[model samples]
Structures are given as C-alpha cells and as structure tokens.
Target chain A: MLPVATGEFDLIRRYFTGLGGDGDGIDLAVGDDCALLSIPADRQLAVTTDTLVESVHFPANCDPALLARRALRVNLSDLAAMGARPLGFQLALTLPSVDVSWLAAFSLGLAQDASTFQCPLVGGDTTKGPLTLSITLMGTVERNHALRRDGAADGDYLYVTGTPGDAGGGLAIMTSGGERHNQYLLERYWLPTPRLAAGELLAGFASAAIDVSDGLVQDAGHLCHHSGLGCTLVWDQLPLSTPLVDEFGVEQATRWALSAGDDYELCFSVPPGRAAEMELAMAGAGEQVTRIGVMGRGISGVSCVSSDGQPFRLEQAGYAHF
Target chain B: MLPVATGEFDLIRRYFTGLGGDGDGIDLAVGDDCALLSIPADRQLAVTTDTLVESVHFPANCDPALLARRALRVNLSDLAAMGARPLGFQLALTLPSVDVSWLAAFSLGLAQDASTFQCPLVGGDTTKGPLTLSITLMGTVERNHALRRDGAADGDYLYVTGTPGDAGGGLAIMTSGGERHNQYLLERYWLPTPRLAAGELLAGFASAAIDVSDGLVQDAGHLCHHSGLGCTLVWDQLPLSTPLVDEFGVEQATRWALSAGDDYELCFSVPPGRAAEMELAMAGAGEQVTRIGVMGRGISGVSCVSSDGQPFRLEQAGYAHF
Candidate 1:
C-alpha cells in the first residue's frame, strides 16, 4: 500500500481522484491547489467541520467503514441545522501506519456516504500521525434563508425527527454482553441518517433549529440558550425506538433518548400554527416528525415533564467539548 | 493540566469562543452549533485544510507557540496558491492533556499571526487524543480570477518569493549534530509566513501559481507537469538565506534551496509581457520576487542550470506526502 506521506499526488490519486467527482456544485475537485465550488445563484453556502480521534471520540478498533460514515454524517447533521443541502466535503486524515486493508474499507465507507448523500469529495490532506479524521462539509441553502438557533420564541413547538435512544441502547448492548455487532444497533450507532430533507422542509417554517448531536435535552438547551428562551419538554412525546423500549423499558428509554449523543436527528422549533404544515411536509418526504415540547420565555434552560406531568431531571446534561 | 475530554466547555470557551468572531465575512462565529460565513457577493471562497501530529509532523516536545503558528500557516499557504485573500480559519485540536499555560502561549502565537495577517479564527473543535491539530482555512478571490497550476504555458517565466530552504535548514539542524538551536533557523521552521499578500498580488498577473510547501523544484515540477510543460531553472539565481549559506556552504545550500520543504512562499509563472508588471506587483506588496526558471515544452520535468549553463540535477526531487 502506498503511504500518504510518500507523495500527496499519489495519495490523492489513490483515495480521492476517482471518487465523489460526479456531483453538482463541484466546479473543481481534488488533486488541485484548492477546490472550487460554485454556489447556485440563489443559494448560500453552509460549512461545518468535525474531527474524530481514535480512543477519544471512538474506539480504536471500531469498524473502519462505519467510523468513516459516522464522521461524515455528523458533519452532514450540522448542515441539517442550517437547512442546507450537502454539496461537498474535504477530509484530513492522519494515521499511525499505512494499513491498506483498513484504508480500503475506510475509503469505501467514505465513498459510499459521499455517493449516497450526493456530496462530492473536493480536496483534503493525508498525513502521518495518531489516527485522526477531520471532515469539513459544505452545503447550500437559499440566500438569507438559512436557519439560525436564535430564532426560537415563546410558544414555538419543539419537534424531533426520527426515533432516538437506539444509539444509546446500542452503546449499552455493545459495551455489555448482548451482542458486539448487532447490525441494527451498530448501524444506528455508526451510520446515522442526517435529517436533510426534513431540515430543508422546515427551513422557513422552523423557528430555531439544531441537530440532535449531543442529545435531545442538551441540544434543546442550545437552541433555547442561543435564542434566549426556555423550553418545556413533554417526555411522553419523545419518539423512542422499539429496541430501546424493549431493552431499557419506557422510563429508561426516555431518559436515554434525552441524554444519548450521536443521534443526528433534527430537533427544531416551529410556530404553533406551522405544526400541521410540518406534518404535511414530513408526509411528503415520507419521514416522521415527532413533537417533543414547546418553547417559552424566561431564563434559558430546559425543563422536562414525565408522562404524569411531573418535572424530570437528568444526572448528565450533555456531551461538552473542552 | 486537564485532559481535554475532562475540560470540554472551558477549553472551547477559552481557546475558540471569540477568537475569530470579528472577521470580515463571518456571519456567525463559534459558540454555535456551526459557523456561518458569507462569501462576499463578488468573490468565491477558497478552502484548504491540513493536520499535524506529534512525533510525526513535529517532535513531541516541539515549541507549542511555533507548532500552533505552522498549523495554520501551512493551510494559509494553500490559499496563497489560489491567489485568495485570507479571511478566517477553523481549527480542530485533539490533545492528550490540556496544559493551560501551554495553550495560552500557543493561542498567543496564533493571535499574533491572526492579527498580523487580518485572518480570524472562526470555528474549531477541541477533543482528547494524542496531540493533533487540524486547520481549515477559507479565503476569498474574485470570481474566475484565481491562479491555478493548470494555466501555465510554454515559455512562461517561473518565479519564487523570498529565500528558500530556511525551514529545511532548520529541520536539518535539528536532525544533524553539532549545531546548537539557532533561534533564526528554528523560527523559520516553526513560524512560517504565509504569502497572502503576494498571492493576492499574483492573482490577475500570474499565468499559473502554487505555494512552495514541498520545495521549489518539486512544487514547480507540479506546476510544469500539470501545465504540460518542462522547466529550466538557473540554479545560481536561486535565493538563499545568509544563515543557510553560512551553515551549509554554497553547494549544499543550493541543494537545500532546491529540494527542502515548508517554505510557504509563492512560486508562480508569468508571461514575458507581464514580467515587469508582476515585478511591480511584488514590489508593491513588499515581498521578494526572484526569476528562477522558464517553462518550455519538452521532457515535461524540471531541470536546473548552473551559472555557466550546465545541467543541474539532484538525486532526489522534493518532499513527498506519501
């Protein structure tokens, strides 16, 4: 296998040249000094980046393909926040050694996600180091219409797309003895479906938006805090996966749904009247849009109510970056 | 010292929160789910990223301040290739532990460059890992006016900015015996100056351009090879630093100037008619511009000629990424 440090040209040809080249908004792709992107006349570009490190953000021996997809997906989930369409992304990869099989699998995973998501690989750098991957994603949204977290207001309804807590349940199972490689849970933990369509559909309708990366409650707190508003969550309304309920029970599943990271679901707030419109949009996209809570004015924080309408609190707030 | 995974929020707040918030085209800054940037109405953004790892890219005990500066400067050099104006950058740092004092000094050096170059720190991710730093920079250029290596033509004059091989000289000094830590050489290796002003000046004037990160001869080879031309270098005209000449002698200094990397200077081609104009541009920017070679159609590689016009060739070409 060719090492990236041997020559950048060889590395580019081997891993990126043939992949992610056939996509829109990519004026110039990899193997160039810098990638050239053409933003559509009426669209604005949105960019987000995330870095995942071995034994820190993920396990050292984690599935290479799945890890690649997850890293890109997390950045895509950020695009979902701005209601942007994924255009392309650049990756910076650092590895301790030149392991061909691992690189093949990892590149396959990245290529698969890029194709599936219609995001081209534009440019990147590969270097020698402790295993690390940084992906910078670019997306497009209507000019001046990108979603912002400071748009939430009192009386807005909070909604989350898709089921949550499956990832948390998967983590529990993976860490324990049930199954080290349950396809469904592992897929949930690794290959997340970034709620792009739902976010695009919610662009003008949603008041404040954020992806459920850190967790439902934690991300909700972000929206509220950024918008300078408080939010009330109806725990009974949170969408929990069947596997989560079966494994952890409804109460524990709800708690997990509130605190688990890596969900990649969109948690957004819409005005009360637009709730029905959001449902219609979801129906058109063949996706679920579950209402979870309501936004309110006051000190910026999150409050949760159980099935019986009592206040609920969690021991862990969210995953924080230092 | 707090390990990054343990001091998440505080680290982000201290290192990233408001660092690049006041940049020219930044729509939104850090402390959000994702950064928002506005590509100027008449310009396109040039994006590039690079990652450095401890013990691989640099020694584990490398000076923190210098390491931080190079982490961003190298990426800026990529922007320089595209003839883009430095706007801002994002950093993703993964460290085993957070030494507050070290981070402070590192940030101080970063701020010095940021302030000097008018580029701001817009966003970044901080995590725990074996020490690694990835920087993604965004710059702006007038639509369709960016310099590219693909635009070079036969008979174009090749030019390079400033002295070459100081960084390589510093690296050699570090690896070789007998030479104590020379502050000048060491600083060159560590705190590289990105040729932003020079690049902007070359935007409309140069036929093709690239920044010398992988030595002049090798990188110029890229410009020539990509442009389907061969290049002839006048070796005696090659620029060198006083320290490099004093330390390595003329022949070795010439070799280092030809083949060493990490200079972060611009190398470009200009039509004969535009040579005087290009010189004025370089002069206006207060950067050294030296004519080193000429591009021609032939073997499609680089060759150096001595003052007497004899062929000059090295056993090896330049830095290979691998």
Candidate 2:
C-alpha cells in the first residue's frame, strides 16, 4: 500500500504558493479566495482554456516534468496565435493519489515556463481523481489588434514560424523506440517553445493567424473556412528540419509536415507586398519564418501541389476528438 | 455499446455557443483562438477556479443539470467573497462518452445560471475523458476596495449571511436515501446560491471575508488563522432552518452546522459599531445575516460554547480532501 500524504490545502501551501511571485499587476495572490489582477488601462484581456487528460492528451507514463511544460505551452500557444502578451494563469490539477516527487518535478517545470513567458501563476485548485490538468490563461492585447481567423484576404501569402514537422517526427521516433535518445526530435516533442515574440511582431502586419495543433492542412482548412477563401500549399517549400529529412527522407518528411499534428507552430497570412517587411521585422527574433502557401478566391478548403505540379492526397487530414 | 455522437467541436457548437449571449464586455466570443474581454478602466479583475469530479464531489449518476449549476455556483461563491461583480467565465468539461441527453441537460443548467448571475460564458474547451467539470470565473472589483481575509480586527463581530448547515443536511438526506425528494434540502444541496448581493453590499463595511465552503467552524478557523486572531461561537445562535431541525434532531443539526461542509454562504467580520449599517444593507437581500461569534487576540482557531456556558467539542472540524 502507498503511504498517505498531506491533504489538499497543505499540499498546495507547501508546493505552489511561491510560484510566479508577486508581480506588479497582481493585487492579490494565492491563499485568498480569488486573485485580483489590474489589467492595464489600454489593453483588452485575452482568455483561453485547455484541458489534458491522461492517456488522451499524452502517453500513460510520460515524464511528469515534461508533461507540465507541454500542458502550459499549448495554452500559451493559443495566446501567441491571438497576438496577446502573457499576463497570468490559473491551474486546476486532479490526481488519483499523492506522489511527492511527481508534484515537485511538475511544479518546477511549470515555474520555469511561467518565469520564461512572464505569465505568473495567479490561482489554482487541486483535487483527487484520475490525473487531469486544466489551465485558463489570461493575456493582454491592444483593443483592435487581436489576430482573428477571418481576416485573411484572397491573395495573401501564408507563412508559418519555425520548422513545422520536427515535433511530429519526434513523436514518431519516441513512440517507435528505434532511436530512443535522438536528442533533437525528443526535445522538440517534449519542450516546444511558443512563438511569443514573433506573434507580437505580427500583430499589425498579419491578416490572419492560427496555431498548427491539428496538422498543417486541417488548421489551414480552419483558416480558409473562417476567411471564406481557398488555400494552395506548395509542397516542396514546406519547411522540414534537416534532422527529420535525414531520418525519414524527403517524401516521408513531407507527409509528416502536411498531415501530423501537435507541431504547435503559428501559421498566419500577410499581404503579398508586406512579406519583405514582415521578414525584416522577424529577422532578429531567432525563429525562421517560412512562406509555404497562398490564399485564393474559390471554395473554402486546402489543396496541395507537389513539385511536378500534380495534386497530392493523404489518408487523413489530422486528429479529431470524439 | 453507446451510439456515437458528434465530435467535440460539433458538440460545443450545437449546445454551448448560444449560452450567456454576447454580453457587453466581451470583445470576442467563442469561435476564436482566445476570447477577448474589455475590462473597465477603474476595475480590477477578480479570478477564481474550481473543479468537481464524479463520485468524489458528488454521487454517481447525479442529475447533470444540477451538477452544472453547483459547479458554477461554487466558483461564483469565491468571487462573492472578494466583493466582486460577475464579468464572465470559461468552462473546461471532460466526459467519458458522448451522451446527447446529458449534454443537453447540463448545458441548460449552465445557461440558466450564467443568465441569472449576469456571468456570461465567454470561452471553453471540451474533451473526452472521465466525467469532470472545471470552471474559471472572472469578475471586477474597485481598486483598494476588494475584501481580503487578513483585514479583521480583534474586536470585530463575525457574521454569516444565510442559514448554514442546510446543504450539509441536504447531503445527508441525499446519501441516506431517506427523504430524498424533500425539495428544500435537495435543492439546497443541488443549487446553493452565492451571496452576490450581500457580498457586494459588504464591500466597504466588512473587515475580512471568506466564503463558508468547508463548514462554519472550519471556515471561521480559516478567517481567524489568517487574521492572526481567535474566535468563539455561540452554539445556540447558529442559524438552522426549521426543515433541517425537523429532519435531524437539534444535536445532530448543530453538529452538521459546525462540522459538515459544502455551505456556500459568506462568513465575514465587521467593525463593532457597523453592525446596524450592515444589517440595514442586507435586510432586503432575501437572506438573513446572523451574528454567531466575535474575534479576539489569542490562539488562531475557533472554539464553541453551549447556551449553558459549557465547552462543546466535536469529532472533527470539517471535511478534508485527500
């Protein structure tokens, strides 16, 4: 039998109180019934919520620390897509039993991301049940500058930040256990960074944006459906990391790039003439921005063309939760 | 086997999109990567989150509609304790399978409460998992006026809005399978109302405030611990409804009032001379304010005395989550 641990209140006090320390915007913090935050006068609050359940979102026995980072990062990626600056977040964590080491590592990873992104942990709830995590993150964006999915024009160039297929390739590598210690792919899978800086820079320039969570094609379909436009992707120009290409070859890597999900990179559209200006703005942001497609007036969906100008087809678009 | 329903996104669009219909402060509603809220310039945002799990927070097979109301109300009670007015909320709901009838009933209760409390549903996430409901509520309070748990003075009078222990008695009746259809007790358990009006009125008058979630005595001990003071409760003065007394004898009802949990009322402290003003403020609010104790400088916990001036002790202070 497992040893009994301290109750919920004590566990929270011992582990979670000192996180995201008393920042200027927080009028009240943990230990209170509700946290009070002073939103800056000129900014509107952007809120998003995401929940990860065991075995559904992640594998059954994934590392606790890495799970913590991925959970928070996915929510942060939503803010990035909306062109919002991080403010703070609240966590609701449910567990089947108390495990001190797991809690310690999880909180450490959460604290690291919170500090790095400047999003403090304002308040949270911990309960007993099957392991599940729910995070509601709040951010700030200028009143009319929030990037929407319906703003793309008929002839805009579609661009994505960072390499698109590395995380998906990494997930495959981790699951197959062929090369268990491939540092690049494993790290990409475990610790994908949200493109906060590029998102902020894209606020005034990009016409539309979305994070690629459910494959490039499915998410592009989302953009087209909302904007009432059709999208065409040039298959050869799809960004692929050298490691992924080396491991899986060009054809397989392209498939992963187009059809695999959980990449967490931002895909947005800019007016064709402003591509150079957007490129110059992102030059010093340390992320490579790739123009992979173009939007057009027609039916509202995504189509792919290979280097030889032939249409490409795949088995499925992306993941769907039912 | 159960029949397959629509996917997660379709389910949300079908049932939840029309809830809490586009309110004044919401700049962006459901269909976006993030919901945008425009906070008033002079108001601070008050935030709180809570999660309820199946078979832990409530019995198995409980009514979905009632569970929805209870989940949202408990979070609203936290905002009420901070003297904040409702702004909006985001929900993260998890379920074992797609049950159309269950989803319809749950969303109905949620929509009803969202309308009544003036807290609209701004954003949410739905996923497939074991039954769980998590809500994060946001509200607004004036700067420097939000109540805290550390503001009580040594001589402040401790008061609780509404009769306590009814929910506990209701829970007892529910679990015992006797008098299960008693509307008053069952409704008290299923739809505990947050003291929003009283809390808003107590903003400037109450010294320290907390919502009585974990029984009266245990929650009072929380106030005393935070305020660096001690409290003494007059056992006979505990406000017990006639129905609760009739169902359970006086001694058992008193025990429930002291140690049973899940009472969503406001327990607060007011200065000695402001009782009359506080009473006048709460007179027409549809709930009685009962003064059951006083604060003093001593050990930080709560003690009770019988009407005959003898010490009264119970087996435990309140419910513990472990």
Candidate 3:
C-alpha cells in the first residue's frame, strides 16, 4: 500500500519526513521498509491505535491541521490513560486526492503536536482513498506501572481532568454552522489536550483510569465493568467548561458532560484514602482534577444522582461506530 | 473512534477478541486502552503500516478471508524484507457497515496467518467508512542486521526469491473475470507468501534487500537509487512459473516479470564473491533464489538486456496509486 503514487513521497518528504528528527529513539526512520525503533529495555511498549473517518468522525471540510492535531492528541490521550510516556507514532493516512496546501497544514499541525508531546512521527503510509487517518502511537511505560480498568476497587474516588463534553458541544456548534463566538469551545473541539503529564504522574498511584472519549458515563462503564464494580456520578459535580455551560445552558451542558463524547480528558479512580494526596500531587504538577463520582458495588451499572438523591438519566449512551 | 455501535462490540468480541490467544508476547491485548507489549531491549522494532482500500486494492466483492490474509501478508512482507521477526500487529478496519459472516471469515483468515507468522493481534480500532483496512505491524530485528536498500555495493549479485510477477498476472485475470481456471495465479495474487525465513537467513549476509511489491523494475530502481549504483537485469535469467507462461505467453510473462507489481517476493543483492555461498545457504533453508541480474556503477539507472544482448523496454513503469 506504499511506494505511494508519484508525488506521494514528495508530499511525505517535503512535509512529513522531517517530523522525526535525530535522537528520538528511532534507529531508522522513513524511506525504509520498516522503521527501526529503539525502545528502552526496562520500559514496556504501550501501543494504541485510532482511526478517524472524514464524514463520520469530524466535519468533512475543516482545518486539516486541526484535524491532524485532534487525531494525534486523542491517541496520545490513550497513552496518557495508560500512564505511558510518549515515544513515537506511525500515521497511515488515506486521501481521496492530493492537496498540497491541505497537506502542508496537516503536517504542520502534526509537527506542532509531535513537538509538544515529545512524540515524533517515526513512520507513515499514504494511499489514495476516502480521507481516513489511522494512527498507531507507541509509548514507553515502566513495567507493570500501566493504569488499567481492572485496577479499580470498590469505594474508590472517581476524578476527571478538565471539563468533559465541551468538545461534543463544540461539534454541535460546528455542525449547526452557527456563529463562532465561543473560541474556547471551538478550540476544545479542535484540540482536546492529552493529559500526558497527569497520566505519568498517576501511573502507579491511580486505581483505574480511562480517557473520556465516548462520553464520561459510558467510558466510566468500561472501568466499572472491567473492575467488577459500579459507579455513582454526581450530576452537580460534573466539570463543565464555563463557555459550554453559558452557551448550551446547564441542562444541556449536564447532558453533554454525561453523554456526549470527544472530551479526551482523563477520568480515573483512586482509593478514597489517597484521594486527597493524589489531588495534591496533580495540583502540584499544574493539573486540575475534579472528584465527580465514586466507585461502589451498590449499583448494578452506572448511576447519576443530583444533590437531593434524585436520579438522572441519559437519552443515548454515547457515540458508537458501526 | 471505538466504543462502537450496539453490535460493534459483539462483532469484535465474537470474531476478533479471541485472535491473539493466551501467550504471544502480548502483556495486554484487545479491549484495553493500550496493548502492553514486551520488546527485547537489544532488538529494535521494525514497524510498517499499510492500508488497503476497497475497489482500489482489491475487488469490490471477494472472499473476506483471502482479503484479510492479503492485508496482513503484504505488511508481513515488509517485515520480512527488513529481516525482522514478527512480534504483533494492530488492525484499524473502517467499514461501511458491519457484516457478521464477513467478519467471521475475515477474522478466521487473520487468526490462521497471525498464528502461522507468530504475530499476535495486539490491538485494533474499528470504525464505519468506505471499507478500508490499515494495519500497523511491528517486528523485532537485531540492532544492526536489518537489510536496507542503501546497503548494496556497486558490484553485487541481484537475486530474487521465488518467481515474481505471477501475482500481477493474477490481478489481471481477476479484473477481466474471463476465467478462474488458473488457481495458481489466483492464489499468488491472493496469497503472496512473505519470505520471512529467507529474510532471517539473509539478515547479516545480504548487502541490500527489498520486497518486490511495486514492480521488480521500480523497486530495483529504489535499491539502485539509494545504494548509489545502477543495475543490469538479465532478462533470460528471470524465473517464471509454467502456469503464468502458458496463460499469458512468454512476451506478456516477460513484461509482467519485468514491470508488474504485487509479487511480495524478496529482491536482494549480495557481493558477487559471496553469491554462490549465499545461494547455498538459501538452498539449505529449502528456499530458492535466482541470480537474475548484477548491480554495478556502469549505468545511471536500470537497464535490461536479453540473452542476445538486445536492450529491452516496457510500455509502462508500474502501478501508481494516484
């Protein structure tokens, strides 16, 4: 699927080949049949893959650079959830046609994020097809230090980093073709930061962890199901960005926070006894986390309750790919 | 783009989750945020990515099992070209819709090949789109033993494993839909064997190596371009299958052998002094290799000559993606 077209190499060489510079743990980079990567012996490789379809995942026509950033960042969020430090990534990008300017912006965006996360673009594959991006990002984690869904225990404190569901709201705004007054929401939609530092900090400490991609409540279900526990999320404590709340109002924001996806924020659980200490550690590291729920065995599945012990329900579970 | 639709998990859990099995170098396999893998510190990872789009790479409708095999084998071919041992692979499949029986067959095909190659399914991302499969396969190779295009010397024997161009002939047969009588060519097209063992045997021996996927002439040009040498391909020395020769005749067979792609065979070069020794080594391994040409600095690019010393020419270079 490579030896990609005539100018495909030019596109990659001109825009992408320079992404992974010297001393990035890459023994050999592009132009070879395979990229030879040097992973530290003591560290285990953490591999996560994500594929974004043009019409299904994002707007058909948007900033290509932002799309590139979002694609890489969301995958980084997975590495973050596993408490793996960024290493390098392979991008298999399919396009319907070659657009030089679009590729320029896309590669630029990838370059920026690769630099920001210290994850260089080690290798890539390009083909002609409907615009699709499949990125396989690898990271390094200390042996047995990966935060997993099964690590959670009953009665652990569930914490979420940053606001959840703002990106979903941003998507809503973009889809409606509405006035783009809320730059914060748009940026959140375009750039959902991967909590890499927080993930590294929480590696051995957190009981269980996951990124809020397919909504907070649904992904929380995964943690609960895998851990054989149930969770109770307090509606009032849900972290909603001010812009999202102001634009979509509290009820919608509450639903978005609970049901809408594409947040990319970390939703992790820690032992209640260590909750205060973990919070302190995160704060010291310049990260913000809100304790919005508690893991328990009382509930069968995920439950949402308001201040008065009132039950809250979601219309749909989360984003689904069929 | 996971957290798939209602039946998506059912599809994955039923057909895919059981692929890697219990022990295959996967610390953590599917269903996790990231797959935890153990790569020996001394060995570098040989990573390659490939994407096959529907109607572009293969027929719109075909046996899902063969398609799956082709998808994985071509990528494995890249690993074999680098003389790397297969470790694991991640498949990102984007489909227009979920088909149950299709997935069952596809997963079965993948299971057979993954088990045969010793490359387990580490992780995967499934989404909805115009049927596209992007696979990122990783292998482990000794730090400095990887055979590269640039490793060739000015004077070396250009050797190829197995017969090339049969798969291209197979593709031609498939597209015309004239007759399916030639099962050999069809199998060659569907299952281009990845010469993994030969690659391992050639690791430190061969000066340069590349899998013949994008036509022998073009790929050989890559070897010449990178190694700063030209090549003289002896036309009469090329190995051709009896079935291919009978079906397409000698002229077409010669053209196909010279310029058609999708052969998945290894085209490698070794110093002339060691060519016989390397040939004996390959013979010991029960693999066949033919010295079809010689690499040299005599010409600026690739030149082909027949037995009578007449120069040969082609109508087209090879397949182009765009």
Q: Is the docking of candidate 2 incorrect, acceptable, medium or high quality?
A: medium
Residue-by-residue lDDT tens digits, candidate 2, A1-322:
0011237777898778868666668878778899999898889999999999998888887888899899899999999999999888999999998899999999998888888888888998998898999999999998899998999999999999888888888898888867555689778877887888888889979999999887888888778878988888887899899998988888888887887888889999999999999988888667689999899996447878865777777777777786
Please say which candidate is ahead in DockQ: 1 or 2: 2
Note the residue pairs that clash in candidate 2. B95-B129
Per-residue accuracy of model 3 over B21-133 as CA lDDT, tens digit each? 64445788888899998888778889999999998887787899999999999999999999999999999999888888888899999999888888888887999999999
CA-RMSD of model 1: 3.3
The candidate, 1 or 3, that scores higher on TM-score is 3
Q: Which ten residues in a row have the lowest lDDT in candidate 1 chain A?
A: A1-10
Q: Which stretches of candidate 1 lie over 4 Å from their true place?
A: A1-6, A177-182, A298-300, A320-322, B1-7, B174-178, B313-315
By DockQ: ranked, best first: 3, 2, 1
User: What lDDT is reached at residue B11 by model 1?
Assistant: 75
lDDT of 1 at B98: 79
- Please give, for residues B86-202, the per-residue lDDT of candidate 2 as tens digits: 999999999998899999999999999989998888897998898999999999988888988999999899999877888888898888867455679778878988988888889
Give the top-scoring candidate (DockQ).
3
Q: By descending TM-score, how would the candidates be arranged?
A: 3, 2, 1
lDDT digits (tens) for residues B111-159 of candidate 1: 8777777788877788778888888888888899888888988888999
Q: State in Å the error of residue B112, model 2.
A: 1.0
Residue A47, model 2: Cα distance from true site in angstroms: 0.7
